[model samples]
Target: MSSLPPASFQTPRQIFAAFDRGDLSRESFREAMNEHALQLIEEMEEVHQNPVAAWMEHLRSRRAAGKLGREYGEAMVRELLVALSEVPEFPLARWIWNADRPHLPLYCFLRPKAEPVFRIQKIVCAPFVVMVRVEYGSSEKSATVREKFTFTRDQVGRLRMSGRERVK
Candidate 1:
């Protein structure tokens, strides 16, 4: 189970004020953000199990070509991650930073290091430059990774249509 900060904790505005005033250490702010992220993950898991169950059901329906397209997008993201992991760290960061890419659709994997629980699914129309974060609860450790593979006009044109029109 993920542990969250107490409800009486400072709000984002308050935290930002402290940060701006140099009253809050950067490390403390980071830890707070990590905690907030874990809480969000917990909430998302709840929704995935219930309120969002309909979405999963829709994934099985006959009119799910959009979902199929999302699956393909996810496969592309996985391939990208695998390729990124192969590159040396510094060079990969430099390349990603310098690359002018547009946002592509994505699927994400969230695994809890302390537990056997994991979630994997597609995100529709997510920006390519968005941050990806991995958190380890036991050690209160986290890492973020971002990619810069935006789709060019020509690349968008090459995407498989699957009878359904591309989402604008």
Candidate 2:
């Protein structure tokens, strides 16, 4: 008897053999993959719905904290939540080509015990228009730092396409 679940029914060998030496359409492959994922999620939800299984999960969590220490267990949960909550906001495919190129100035702050030098780079738009203030540091040697606010879309676009010259 096979211990493999129904979700593993479509093995990697089968899928690859099915597409042997042939070009597969992007839309068709995407649809098939999406359906497979949905089915797996449904099966997992079913497994987690049992009362005995739920109690086992609670016991496991308590045991983990006892073994690892309370701080370590709490840190693990916090990190997991942070990872789960993070969504890639940028469009990766479109931005990949320009990722290496410098667009905006990145901001940096150095402690007095360290180099005593500070830099503010790649400052861009803020979320709110009226309520928030945007500021950047000047030269590290300077006594007074200059603050800059307000940026235009044209400025950002120009930075994004910095290397190439415009054709007349």
Query: Can you give the TM-score per candidate against the true fold?
Result: 0.28, 0.24
Query: Which has the greatest TM-score?
Result: 1
lDDT of 2 at 61: 41
TM-score of 1: 0.28
Which whole-number lDDT from 0 to 100 does residue 16 have in model 2? 45
- Candidate 2: residue 117 Cα off by (Å): 66
Instruction: Encode model 1's per-residue lDDT on 16-113: one tens digit a residue.
Output: 66788998799988876576567558756865667555354334332333443455554544443333322233122211221113343221222323
lDDT of 2 by residue, 1-168 (tens): 001123323332234444564544656555655655675476457547765754554454445434433433333322222221121221111112222223411111111111211222222222221111111122233432333223222333321211211111
Residue 19 of model 2 has an lDDT of: 55
RMSD of each: 15.8, 20.4
